[model samples]
Target: MEGYKKIIKKLLFFNEPKKMERFVLKETSSKENRTEDSAENNAEKDKQYRARRRKEPGGIRKIDRGTDESSKKEKEIQKEDENKRKDSEVSVYLSHNLTSMKRLYNIPMNGDVVIREFDIILKDRAVGAFIIFFDGMTDRKVINNNILQPLMMLSSLEIKKAEEDIAEYIKKQILPHNQMKEFTSYRKIMDEVNFGGCAIFVDGIAKAFTGDVKGWEHRGVERPNTELVIRGPQEGFTETIRTNTALIRKRLKDEDLICQNFEIGERSNTPCSMMYIKDIANESLVEEVAKRLKSLKVDYLSDSGELEQFIEDSSFLPAPQIIATERPDRVATALTEGRVAVIMHGSPFVLIMPITAEDMVKSPEDNYVRFPYGNLFRLIRYFGIALSLLLPGLYIAITNYHQEMIPTDLLFSIEAAREMVPFPSVIEILIMEIAFELIREAGIRIPGPIGPTLGIIGALILGQAAVAANIVSPVLIIIVAVTGIGSFAAPNFSLAFSFRILRFAFIIIGAMAGFLGITTGLFIYGMWLVSAKSFGVPFLVPFGPKTANAFTDSILRAPIWKQERRPDYLNPKDDRRQAPISRGWMDNGSKGEDEDEQ
Candidate 1:
């Protein structure tokens, strides 16, 4: 141990500047050319070496030779200087080489390492070589048969193949049974390998050869259960972007459909893609969405939901400012409307930005049906929204304060129903509303057959039991149930939740001051709705503030022939969507019959 300590001390002495300078100048310079300090130090060291050599003649004596020679030996001194300079250069090279070698070879005892016993001898000269093994990363047979078996059969000489040759060899022979792509840089290769790729590092080369090993695991395309339609394509967006795009492209066979990609996050390297029609879509909207998505500086991203929050106009907004949809038709519709769709690599849902309140209320199914029925359905949705948001609040306001709006007979009936109830009308309504929301949430969270059963049983058993127990009035329970059903009638889940939250506030306001309070609450809520912006577009556009396209498909759907243009809110440069001549088909048919009779 003592001798080993001495050896380590002597090795580390090379790191000291003064000693290093003395050592280098003596070895790398002639006696005449040597620095004064080097000459003096070499002379002292030589004297000590001579004394030691005299005392112990058999032992090796270390001496500095450059300083002891005469002036007539100037030529020799010059030769020695050149030779020493070369030696010094070699020594410096060796020092750096050894330092790097030590760093790479000195594996920490506490860190991760695997000791693999191989029959073939490893080259003793190389110091930085290491073996990396990943548990469960492959079929052991694939590793042994495809990789290790070939490697074990090769001589020590075969370990040093050039990167390109190794890549070509793997492609031709070793990985012949499987498809693989080769990459040059180790960093790129390592990334691929970590994500189920295979990498081979040659003995001498800095670059590593990598093979693509992307696992065959992806869900098949299925009809979007969430965004169901009666008269459109049954297929929907899948986790695979390729599958999702196919669903869209099946509907639109245009070559102009553009899909542009951006790599986000330094570590996560999350791939985000923007899709739009090159001709029909607005370039600025595409650019804006792309710019915002690219500017995100998150550490990691796993879903479109995370990306949506980052890129939305205001992250703190209670209502979802950007609409997320699973339906390809919905996305295609948004693209036609000049809105941008952001799709992430692994996410099934694509986010549509700058969507208005009317946009949330309307469904893709509306466009597929006849205009009259579509108009009727859309009106029902509008009524659903009004009933969902205002019914409970209105009930509380009318019953508590504005009895004039209620008929004497109805008021008498309500009074009789509330006679047994202990809580006020507002309290009873809130309790039932909250209970319905709980049941709805629980229904969604529980799995399969149990979910629907739990919801039905929970609502029925709980609501009925509460009413019969005089915990809530029958009339209030009816109002809460109607409100819950109305909220469900909304097309978007996020919009429904927003309506639910807003209804609670209306209930509070109605309870506080009756009709005046309800009126004030509606007024304030209207302002908030009007003031809200979905990526700078008025939330209540085409309805609350009203635009010319307001009549096109706002509260009611117009006949396809009547809507000659897309929504004006989209800022579509080519506004016209269909031909004007198509509007007179039925009329022209009737006129043609009369002319034929004449």
Candidate 2:
């Protein structure tokens, strides 16, 4: 062994340390010398190469080389040219000549852009004028009767002063349209014209007058198809934002309910209205909402849903931070609660923000019904939420890991139902759940009257066939049916969808680790809820943080008189909704007694 060790040490150079060190030092010194010589040779070669290049005819020296400088100057010139092109692309101011206006509108190229040029006969002489409007957008009757008839036929006869300014005289005495504005920017004129309005441009004037002649077809206010209620007002919001705001105004007559209009979407130019009670809502909350809305850089926001997605606090969260409803009463209620409602044009749904879990779970009918029944239904909804989210998971856990916990008779029946089924409980549940979801989606996409019927028939036939074919067990069918019912019971559509997504997650976890996995999932879900914020308000507000006053109205509908304060979580400016003793007349009963005695 010692001889073998000595041989290994010799091979590894561990024996004779001084000799090894000497060898390494000599090699390093030689390498350094070689490197120095190579560097010197490279320097001399570079100097010679430069000298040769300089001696060649028409050869440029290093300092005189202009390739990089020329390229940089070329880039700068291109950048400046691009900036100039962009500036030139900006819309020009309204011109004095009718031909210029026609060219600006691209009259010959765009068939929809109509430029009706006519002679404006004044007392002194006839002046050239034109009206530009988009076809099918503007009301032709208003243009002809209000603008044209007054300017062409009436102005010539009415104007007596021969020296009066033609544009000013026509605007003051001729145009009778209530909504008219004088604008100098052609961009503003185009926007107005695009929005179903007409712009009147004069022959020698640099300014144009625009009138609101929007009379395009829109669906009228109808009963809400999604959020149906029996006791509350049946009127729902229409696609037209003006009509929707009017519906809210009719319900909420309070002058303090302020509706601020904003035009978003560079391409779509979709109108949005932010409604809040000025004196009651928190100023910061209002400002924050407005700031976020203004910060959006999207070009086309088609609906409130799209707007909500753009401005919502978090995109990854399954739960919707805003509540969208077509019911005007719902918007009115939200406004009274110190929450902001965003009403978008072309969408019937209005988005209510800074929403909590309780808000999503509570139906609009909760306020209309008696408090006792409302509270009862609210409790039932809570149960439904739990059932929808956790029931499938619990079933999988119990059958797989806790079968002994089941009662004997029920266990026997469950076993008998599963006898012919070939798949496991989790697989069976997943099959039924996926099948039901497909049916639901098909029902929504399928046209008219047949939708609901098809959903029912599809579910019934599918469930029956699955059981008979021993694909999914009968007990799994019952579980899936109950889960579907529970999902439908959620008041908010977005909240329902979130629960649907979490339901699958719970099922997978439960199948892996049984009840332990389910408990862990619930804990993580609760933690996520506690941490999530909706527009600076906690998602689990008044519950995790424990607001005493707000707790009474959450998950339980208190009497209308008892709910005398808005949600404290909102930090409302005006907290008190009503007097402490709203029924003071009952206490002061002498007036009725005196009348009876008399």
Listed in order, each prediction's TM-score against the native is: 0.69, 0.83
Compared with the true structure, all predictions reach lDDT values of: 0.69, 0.82
Pairs that clash in candidate 1: none
Candidate 1 Cα misplacement greater than 4 A, ranges:
1-187, 190-213, 543-546, 582-598
Q: Least accurate stretch of 10 residues (summed lDDT) in model 1?
A: 85-94
What CA RMSD would you report for each candidate?
Answer: 17.5, 18.1
Per-residue lDDT for 12-70 in model 1, tens only?
A: 88754565434453354455665566778767765654554322121312334344433
Cα misplacement distance, residue 262 of candidate 2 (Å)? 1.5
Q: Model 2 over residues 1-598: C-alpha lDDT tens digits?
A: 9999989888988544455444453232233343444778757745654444332112212222332333333345445543333233212223434554565566698898888878788656787777888888878898899998888888765445442366678778788889999887656677788888898877666677899999888898789988998898899999998899999999999999999988898668888999999998999999999998888777898778899999898898888999999999988888888999999989999999899878899899998999998989888898988999999999999999999999999999999989998888988898888999999999999999899999999999998999889898888888988999999889889999999999999999999999999999999988988999888899998988888679668877678888888899999998888888778896468678888899
